[model samples]
Target: MTELNDQALLRYSRHILLPEIDIEGQTRLLNARALIVGAGGLGSPVALYLASAGVGTLTVVDDDVVELTNLQRQIAHDSASLGHGKAESAARRMRAMNPDIRVVPLAERLEGARLAELVAAHDLVLDCSDNFATRHAVNRAAVVARVPLVSGAAVRFSGQLAVFDPRVETSPCYHCLFPEEGEATDGPCATFGVLSPLVGVIGSLQAVEAVKLLAGIGPSLGRLTLYDALSGDIRQMRVPRDPGCPVCGERR
Candidate 1:
């Protein structure tokens, strides 16, 4: 663990004041490594909050570049990064906000073996990807690595969050909720339009869950937590793992 100096203590004074997250917890956060699987709306705030909160290392993976349309919710990118890779732009912003953090930018989509390799190296994984394929792949890799996965999604006025931890028996994986590869829904956030602040809400919550997992403090919901920004309601449902499910289940 890295030694905490006066400046470090001052930087994290609020966190150190909390009984759940004292100097020890702060140190754990400073030593933790988190892998974020996207750099768009949800990923943007997730990465930003984690970096500001002193997460030791962050690796952002995304194949897309910034465009004028993304400015509505992708806070990490600004007018200056119009054509730059999302991961690079996010990394630069995070690093500028907190020089103490190590931001690794992967300017390519994460899939196949690359996903597994990246998941294995990080202590925790955040599924901020917009697609179900990448989300499922992240879940499988995290289950295989026995790491906690913090998943969040926001489109239109609704957002959902769930934490999948294969390390804990009975906890459901992402695939447990959506079994089959469903047809791509029309009007993904970009086309349908989303309330920008809604993404920040979900993303910040994801970051909180990741920090709690790393520090071993607070109870993170193992099931699904849904937030409806349109109606202002939050619902949580317990999702049990399927014994016969393919991803993390035993063979029949």
Candidate 2:
């Protein structure tokens, strides 16, 4: 582990002070590499919190560009970033927040071999995408790479969070919880109006799980957390791994 400099110690003093995440855990965070898929609503908070928490390297991927409509929930981009690539815009904000870390922005849609290679390179993957296709693709890559994935989604006042660690024998992968064959029609914020803070709630949870995993702390694996903004209720449902799952099962 790389030794923390005086400035880094001062910058992350609060985290280092915690018994759960003392100097050792903070050092782990400083050496961690995180991959964030999408830089929109959910990705914004995930990226910001990870960066501020001193995650050493962050690779943010997104092909979309910032538009006026995104300003409502995408906090990483501002008026000045209008018409710019979402990944780049979010990277800029992350960099601005913590120059001590490295931020890589990929302004392209990741798919196939390229996606798998990127997922293999990272210690952790955070799925903040809106569409089912992208989520499934990312989950497949993470499972194959044996990387822990922090998945989150928010739309129309509903939010969901889950952590899938392929390293754990009993932990369920995203495919085990929501099979690709049973995919629902994607309902993005653009279609059904989303509460602006809903993404923040779920995305923040993603960051928390990511940090815990990177710090060698126990994560909330094999369970799904659901947040209903309308009724103000939060709940968790245990998700079991399918022996017949195509993505992470023995059958595969």
Candidate 3:
């Protein structure tokens, strides 16, 4: 809300020292608000980095409670946090990491008008939910709200990261890449088993993209990045808007 104080400056001196993000970019980070759609896997790193980076307000939405099985990849929760709401648990870690910002924990599923409302209120949205249904709902809310969305998914040893910016006319929304009727291959980590750090890698990239978009530092739009942990490879491809499709299409 106000200019960075001496303590804040000293705290973020390393970031401020970056040629691309000096004082002006740091201020933007200090005033921005972001909505994280899930507080597990991908959301864990995204939430941590955003909080550590000093995003002014973060609203994390999730209805699931932490389970013993989730400890493998859900770094925000541990034995002490079992049965705690994922959003609240992540919020606790965020607050502990950085007390400078506000973290809102929404311990309910986001759907209908409520989803759109939350999307509209924040400057950006990150989709970290595992299911396609939740991804579709979040996509719809984000497209309607016209807020930029950073989405990531990890299963087994592979993961995908995408950044959709409604602010760009030619950018592809989530639906543009994968229509609602597209085949769904969602398998939770608990069922299929995922490498422990796969989420960390993808989630960290989500954090990087989120920070780039927020701080105006690097490229973060109109592309998809896929990573293969087994092969240790990364690939990127351009994703253009679907002119004839629904959701952010020209007809819409």
Candidate 4:
């Protein structure tokens, strides 16, 4: 971990004050690198909090441009950013919030070996993409690279959050919980309207998990959390590693 200057020390004083995250943890945070997938609804809050928390380097990947419809839930982009790339829009906001950190904005969608290579370079990854294809691809990459993954998804009135650390022997991969073809579904926000705040709730949790992982404190949520906005209720389900699963099964 690099040394924190007077300004950095003051900037992250709040995090430093915590018993669980003193100067040592704050230093770790200041030196950590995080990769965030997607820059729309879920990516907005995740990028915001991680940047504000002083994560040293952030790589944001997305291929979509900011449309007027995205303004409703994606807080990172505003009216001025309409038609701009989501990755670039979010990266600008992250730099604006904290110039101390470095933010890389990639306007291309990553897949195959490119995706896995990117995952290997980061200390942690946040999967905030909207589609199952991106999410599953991220899971496979994380599993192969042995990187920790913080995943979140929100649709309509429902939200889900989970922390999957591939370095852990017993933790389950995203593919383990939702098999490739069997559990996949097409529920984009365009098809079924999503409540705006639901994404914030889940995305914020993704930031929490990322910080905990980087700081080396707090209990990792090995279980999946289900949030129902309309019912105002939450449920936790255990995610056991599947020996028969393809992604992490071979590792076991």
Q: Write the per-residue lDDT of candidate 4 for residues 1-252, one digit (tens) a residue.
A: 587999998999999999888888888988999999999999999999999999999999999999999999999999999999999999999999999999999999999999999999999999999888889999999999999999999999999999998888889999888999795684679889999999999999999989989989854656999999999999999988888888999986
Could you estimate the TM-score for every candidate? 0.95, 0.98, 0.96, 0.98
Off by over 4 Å in 3: none
Q: State residue 30's C-alpha deviation in candidate 3, in Å.
A: 0.8
- Per-residue lDDT tens digits of candidate 1, residues 76-110? 99999999999999999999989988999999888
Write one digit per residue (lDDT tens) for candidate 2, span 1-252: 687999999999999989999999999999999999999999999999999999999999999999999999999999999999999999999999999999999999999999999999999999999989999999999989999999999999899999999989998898888888884666788898899999989999999999999988999989999999999999999999998898999623
Best by lDDT: 2
* RMSD, one per candidate, in order: 1.8, 1.1, 1.3, 1.0
In angstroms, what RMSD does candidate 1 have relative to the true structure?
1.8
For lDDT, candidate 2 versus 3, the one ahead is: 2
lDDT against the true structure, per candidate, is 0.88, 0.94, 0.89, 0.92
> In terms of TM-score, how similar is model 4 to the real structure?
0.98
Better structure of 1 and 3 per lDDT: 3
